[model samples]
Target chain A: MTELEIIRLYRSGQQEKAFNLIVENYSERLYWHVRRFVCSHEDTDDLLQEIFVKVWKHLPSFRGDSRLYTWLYRIATNETLNFLHKEKIRASLKFERLSVEMEEKIDDDPYFNGDELQKELLKAIQRLPEKQRIVFTMRYFEDLSYEDLSEILDTSVGALKASYHFAAKKIRTELKKSSIQL
Target chain B: MGKDILDDLKRNPYSVPDGYFDRLKGRLNEIAVSSVDTVPRSLWQRIRPYAALAACFAASFLIGNAILRKTAPGASSSDQFYKELMYSDLIPVTQPYAIFEMEDEEEMETSDEDIINFLIETGVSVELIAYVELLED
Candidate 1:
């Protein structure tokens, strides 16, 4: 279903039907988006559920000021950042580095079928500050345009471009430092 | 990096368990259609972490104060007495009764009623204060 059709269905009081459609249409895409933030399948699964629950809760208040997909991406982005922040705090409380823990999770994940280079690239991505990491992942991996990123992140297009530029540079430097060829 | 190599790497390497999407769809649909909200934390659940953190800070402050009292110059007999009480099996380590035991006699004039009132004013539950009072008894 198109975004308009779903929104119409929701506004027409067929809220459950609209939500189911939203889940059907967006879940797989969102699952991958969230999976990139948290490497573990388990964490991704939990986060996806939470994200959808949030979507459902706030759907009534959705003003359609932006494209539905962009709005959805905004929710996913905020949820991912919040989850990461909470995890970071929890790790710090235990005197552990969240990045180190995430790298270990990536290494030990059975479902990660990436080659050595891909794995190293993912680890380097994890080393980034959280917002930069998300920008890079969305831009580089998901191939989202800067305009879309600007909408989702509420940043200016110019700022988003700079963030992506710096993120890519840092990833390249990190990969080179680890002696991994581009 | 060339666009070709980056595009090649764009192929997602992650995999989910077999039939996971189908299961997830059904689960999410149920959640969406259900009247009960499933995700936001309850007020207590949200507050629990900060509460526990504050409790930890309070405990640490009391323990550190006890240690400082024991090591400070011209330690009093009361400080020694509390130190012995802390080390001995008489009072549980968790019971922070020494918080009320001040080094200066003037500060010692601060009564338990005043302390309990301060704790109540500071948002401590009556149950906890009553438990502490019971410990004092």
Candidate 2:
């Protein structure tokens, strides 16, 4: 279904139908986007449900100023970041490092089916600061352009470029420290 | 650079359980329909946690003051008592009010009320909040 049709259905008060269509179209993509941030399928699943609930509740106020998927990305990014932030606090309360815990989660993640190098890459990526890690995942895994990232992150394109560069360099440094070849 | 193995490991290494998306729509719809008529929380509801914390602090401080008045040997004047309390070994310098300083990097934009509301809304138990408060004490 086209974006216009969805918006029209929403406006016409056929919101549930429009929303189901949206869930069908965007749930998997959004799932992948969120899963890359969280690195746990269970967390991703719970967070995805919350994200879609937010989207449903707030859909009435959506003014169509941006493309629907960009708006959806924006919501997904914010919710995932918020979840991570809370997770960080929870970890701190237990005197645990959030990055270490997340890397451990990646290591034990049953859904993860990568080779040794890919697993190490994910661990290195998890060690990055939150925003930089999200930027790296969205750029490298999801293949989103800087413009899309800028819109979703509400960051300047220049800043996003610099963040991605520093993130890549940091990941390489971490990989080298682990003696992972090239 | 050995052709940058980062570029070589390009395929996404994640998978979901079978038919996860197939069930997601129905699950979300159930939540949405049930929650559609739920009113937004009032401001008072949002700030109740912080207000409770403040009330607890005030009550505890007053009780401590009263106990000090009855028990301290030479804490005659309220001013003198406060002066000693400020300088006394009773309250450690490191632990005082530091837990309340929760303005971390991620929470700079969030208001205190919002944080309290978020904690409560996320099912942080009253005992945990009190435990955090006890940590503050």
Individual DockQ of the candidates?
Answer: 0.41, 0.37
C-alpha lDDT score of every prediction, in listed order: 0.86, 0.85
Off by over 4 Å in 1: A177-182, B1-7, B36-137
The residue-by-residue lDDT of candidate 1 on B1-137, one tens digit each, is: 45433444667889999999999999999886565555767999999999999999999999999999877645656766666655566555587675445345786687878988999999999999999889889
Which candidate number would show the highest DockQ if scored against the true structure? 1
Query: Residue B45, candidate 1: how far off, in angstroms?
Result: 17
- Score residue A109 of candidate 2 by CA lDDT: 91
Listed per model, the TM-scores of chain A against the true chain A are 0.95, 0.94
Q: Candidate 2: which stretches are off by over 4 Å? A: A176-182, B36-137
Q: How much is A143 displaced in model 2, in angstroms? A: 0.8
Lowest lDDT block of 10, candidate 2 chain A? A173-182
Cα lDDT tens digits for candidate 1, A47-121: 988989889989999988999999999999899889999999999999999999999999999999988778888
Worst 10 residues of 1 chain B by lDDT: B1-10
User: Interface RMSDs of all predictions?
Assistant: 1.5, 1.7
lDDT of 2 by residue, B18-61 (tens): 88777876787776577766798999999999999999999999
